[model samples]
Target: MLILECPYCGVAADETELSPGGEAHLVRQGPGSSDQELESYLFGRKNPKGVHFERWRHSYGCGKWFHAARCTMTLEVFATYSAQTPVPPKNVINAIKAKRPDWEGWT
Candidate 1:
């Protein structure tokens, strides 16, 4: 079972207690954006087999949202951080690197 610790509430919650919010740190397309940009933003998502960053909402617990760095293939959670973070923190990146030396890193 997939489990993640809520950074806000510090609760280790299972997947059932949380809500997956798709890929994290997406560049949102807004008004004045071209059709291609909008379409790409909506559909051009990376379904990588390795390290992935994603958003999660602790619905059954504190009801707060956060971001998590994890391995999609092994389900190994590297770290969790605030959703407001624009990019993965240094520690989280280092953690991923320590485990996955060849990880291309966040784009």
Candidate 2:
């Protein structure tokens, strides 16, 4: 039972109230890009076992999409930020590094 804090509505929502929107901050590859770029954009994914960034929509509450930095292994949420952000915030990155010192950085 994952409890996600909704930044918009200030509500702590259960997993059932949210919708997973896949990887966050993906660089979209369109017409001007090469075939490989397009393929990567469409299918390339990070199936990491550790800290990861994701997009989630609060379906049963504010009905807004937001970004979340969490650990895939331990199910620990590092932080949440606006979906409009192109990358996870610096603090979130630092937090992950604190937990996993060996981590190089978020790609």
Candidate 3:
């Protein structure tokens, strides 16, 4: 069991209370896109190995979407924030590695 800190709720929650909401903060395309483009956009996901920005829903609490910086290999969570947070997804990983390289390991 892991405790997830919710930025909005200001409390740590059990992992069971959350649902994996897939990739987070996907860049939106401009209008006038073709079918193939829309299909590719909807299907694409960042299935990376190291740190990744993932969407998670607090099913048992506020029921709002939140962003989490997680490790795909170790399944460790470094930080969590509300959907409205302005931080870029890619920057989260880079910032973590910059602060604590040992925690992430040889980035």
Candidate 4:
């Protein structure tokens, strides 16, 4: 089973103890946005094949949300970080690069 570390609570939680919160770092469309923009925000997802970032909540532990950088094909977790930011931090990016030398980068 997959294991994820919760940054907030410092707990290494098993996959069964967590809940997937979908792709992370998505920009939310608000009131002044067009219908298409709002629609895309509501449903559109890149769903890429390689390196991906996602949100994971420690459902059975601290009940906090965190971000995880992982490989979609291999299901290899590179790193996990706090969910308060809009983008992956530099350390997380570096960790991914160390693990995956061919990574094209994420932004």
Candidate 5:
């Protein structure tokens, strides 16, 4: 069972208690953006085979959204952090690096 700790409420929520919000740190394209840019924003997303960062809403708990760093293949969770940031926290990145030495760093 996939579980994630809510950074806001500190609840160790199971997947049932949370809602997956797809990939995180997406740069939203707005008005005046090129068609390709808009299309990318709407369709392009990272589907990594290893470590992945994603958004989650603690719907059954605090009802807040947060980010999580986890392994896609093994389902191993590294860390969770606030969604307000534009990128994953350094500690989270380091944790991932610790687990996956050849991760090639976050893109």
Candidate 6:
């Protein structure tokens, strides 16, 4: 099992307590695209190796959403933080921040 540090909850938590959102949003290198194209680009994913930052929900813990970085090969959790937390390494912070969806208007 992996110990995931939740941004809202703090401390480490069992992997089972969190729901993994595979592969956080990737930046669009090229410009000039419609919403449908952008949505398709942003929503796409690739199960790659090495360190990958992903969104995770602490469903059983804080019940809030957050992010985590882990190794695809070993499943080793290297880092984690909430959406409100300060920036982290590997361009993840900015990536997640840029891709933050408008959840408030969802309902």
lDDT of 2 by residue, 1-107 (tens): 77889878889989999999999999999989999999999999998998788999999999999988888988998888788788888888988888889976888
Local lDDT at 54 for model 4: 95
Please tell me which model should have the higher TM-score, number 5 or number 6: 5
lDDT of 4 at 91: 98
In candidate 1, what are the lDDT values of residues 9-66, reduced to their tens digit? 8999999999999999999998999999999999999889989999999999999999
Q: Give the alpha-carbon lDDT of every model.
A: 0.94, 0.89, 0.74, 0.92, 0.94, 0.65
The regions of model 3 sitting more than 4 angstroms off are 85-94, 99-107
- Residues 1-92 of candidate 5: C-alpha lDDT, one tens digit per residue: 89999999888999999999999999999999999999999999989998999999999999999999999999999999999999988999
Ranking by TM-score: 5, 1, 2, 4, 3, 6
Scored against the true structure, residue 41 in model 3 reaches a CA lDDT of 71
Question: What are the RMSDs of all candidates, in order?
Answer: 0.8, 1.0, 4.0, 1.1, 0.7, 10.2
- The residue pairs found clashing in candidate 3 are none
Ten residues in a row with the worst lDDT in model 4? 1-10
Which residue pairs overlap in candidate 6's backbone? none
TM-score of 2: 0.94
Q: Write the per-residue lDDT of candidate 3 for residues 1-105, one digit (tens) a residue.
A: 656787788768788998888887775555798777777678977688877777788889988778888777777787787787545445665666875586543
What's the lDDT of the predicted structure labeled candidate 1?
A: 0.94
Residue pairs in steric clash, candidate 1? none
Residue 86 displacement (Å), model 6: 11
Count clashes in each candidate, considering only residues at least 3 apart in sequence or on different chains: 0, 0, 0, 0, 0, 0
Model 1: how large is the Cα RMSD against the reference?
0.8
Query: Which rank order by lDDT, best down to worst?
Result: 5, 1, 4, 2, 3, 6
Error (Å) of candidate 4 at residue 24 is 0.3
